[model samples]
Target: MDHWDEVRMFLAVAEGGTVRAAAEALKVNHATIIRGVGRLEEKLNTKLFEKLATGYRLTDAGSDIVELAGQMATASSQIEARIFGRDQDVSGPLRFTLPISFATDLLMPTLTAFRANYPDIALEILSSGSVVNLGNREADVALRVVVGGASPPENLYGTELCEFHMGFYIARDLACSRSLTPAWLLGANEAVPTDWAPDAGIKMASVPIRFAEMRSQLEAVRAGMGISALPCFLGDADPLLARVPGGPVTHIGDIWLLTHGDTRRTKRVRLLCDDIRSAMQGFAGRLAGRFEGGASEFL
Candidate 1:
């Protein structure tokens, strides 16, 4: 039995939750995954997984080996990088993760400039909201927004990049033509606590829309669908949108830039981090929502 290949297949199946997903991630056919797992179980003389209608569930024996397999994968990657990774030119794959909104609204617009600056660095962006573990090399760096002033994981080393100020925003014409009411638009998955909205001075009216994403919410607000709380950097920059007067900072969060201790000083990683820091610095005022009145410099 080829232990390496067998363990690789097992790891993929365990991580992916289904043979089909494992096959897709590994770029192999479904049959290959099934056969590989079967051979692995045969070698161990134990049923590693229980086949069920929804998906394969790992048995006790399989569950116990997952951590070991993950360790092997990490070690193997490290060895390969140490031996053949071209460290001279700041050239390699750098996996970066951030919230979907940051990627879409902020980074996407300036990615071309980053690409032009660091042509050798292969940038892989993970936009899922799930936090990937930097300790395990799941990602090289992350830009995360956390509310209520919680600290990031102790294992990671980074700093708060900027204050993410939020404000109630509506279309310029909507504010000019009508009185603000409780027709608040919300992200489909967002939960506006029953008491929180009213406590924050937002009076609820009949809502016309529940959008699935922040970008959609922004568009709906632009089209005069409803008012929504949006990041100052996004809402303030748009000429067509205006902040609701007397609406205090709806939410205040900090944008954290983090990286594992292992890669913090890597040339490429450092360069990318610097670029992000500089970009945020340039928009510090807008991001912090600093203003004398309703829409002074922000508007």
Candidate 2:
């Protein structure tokens, strides 16, 4: 294997903590990852990882090497971003990231329009649950939710699309099932105000049904699992879901269409940003939860 490929394999393994995960991330077979890491360890003449039952734990030496490798990756990404930033043409690869739900629920039509207008841009939409660090060139552009009015990273520049809020929601049938005790269906981020359930004017259960992701949480709610704080666009639009009255409408965050400062001027990126901003204006009402909604009988 080439020198950088060896380093890349070792870096992937270190980041993923498991050979299978590294293989999946790199789109290579498990044997390839094992072989590359083995070759790297052989050349370095030291054991980089301690193979544990749980996963590969980095040795002290491995940690040091990983830090250097991370720096190398960052520098390489910066160089690539800078070169791509200077491109003036519309025809080129453009990768962007956003929440999978947001992409499907709110931005699909707008994204379709952008694709229609700029077919040569080679647009790539990355919604996989990955650390989409613009600094690392994981994606060239991003639709990020900056919570609590926080600013985007110093290295990023773009405009705020708008803020979307969440509402307490329950399935219509479940709400009608008066015998069933009320409960919370938690999504990925579990940090929530303790008083939210009480504020809903319902005697909710103390324990929540936890989900690894919001998508499954949404499905659980639809299947009459319990109440959950769902985005207004999602809960309001679903026929089987109904808003629970007497709860605070929590602001998730302002959605921002940002790009690394180095690549902000790239033709395709700028055009796509423009398209999103323009399209967002048309969706301001829906995104901000202007739909006429009926409340579920939660009390």
Candidate 3:
């Protein structure tokens, strides 16, 4: 009880069911976990875990502290949220979580400009497909593409940046082939149907190939592997690719610049949100799928 850090480690191991699992979750060495838990056990004078063939099992004493430890964790997060929300300074670490594809393909310019304009703000990007829990202070802000422009979760607040339009794109040269049978290239993480880049209900194509990531899928399309659906901003910018001749546009969703209500009042967070909204304005045409082929209206 005297060592909060040790109790925290014990809670992690208990929740994760193994020392190694807890270590990975906490981003620490398993040996460090062992040491922490061991110290905690000595401090409390009781054994907390019993290792079985399956995994670690909490002993009576460990079970007793689970609820208390969980409460402690929640209280810690609440304190962090309140303090961070009250911070008015324009300079500090600002963690933003967003989709990997957006980060790699469309966000560099906006992020770079934000950094340049706010040199004191430490920008951190957690670019992945997974959503970071803002309520837990895992990230200060999140950029998400949701099904509709309206109705965000109760805890979040933001403006809808733009509607993200997706289009079936094929290599410019390949689309011109008279006898060509286009195959589908899709993201492996997509549902088995991969309807986002569907065959448009008319097909005479070869089997599809799946890539683990969007960049790989984009590269495959660029290499003329087959047709794929991409955000207009990405596909339209590539000179080698074009929307499939007369293909119908797909509305992926509206991009929302969301921050938990707790952090919305923070100066840096609000400033970054404003910058992103302004940047999105410039690319409104591209996001709406109004590509001019070789022209530069989005510039």
Number of the top-ranking candidate, with lDDT as the measure: 2
Question: Could you give candidate 2's per-residue lDDT for residues 209-284 as a string of tens digits?
Answer: 7889889999988888788888887887898987776667778788787787667777888888888788776766
Task: Please list the residue runs of candidate 1 whose C-alpha ends up more than 4 Å from where it truly belongs after superposition.
Answer: 1-88, 179-182, 188-204, 291-299
lDDT of 1 by residue, 138-238 (tens): 99989888777776664567667778888778777766655566468887666553533433244557645677778778888888776787888788777
Query: For model 1, where is the 10-residue window of minimal lDDT?
Result: 290-299
- lDDT of each model, Cα atoms only? 0.76, 0.78, 0.77
Q: Model 2 scores what on Cα lDDT?
A: 0.78
TM-score, ranked from best to worst: 2, 3, 1
Model 2 segments more than 4 A misplaced: 1-86, 129-131, 188-193, 196-203, 293-299
The per-prediction CA RMSD against the true structure, in angstroms, equals 11.9, 12.5, 12.2
Comparing 2 and 3 on lDDT, the stronger one: 2
Model 3: residue 68 alpha-carbon error in angstroms: 37
Candidate 1's C-alpha lDDT?
A: 0.76
lDDT of 3 at 40: 92
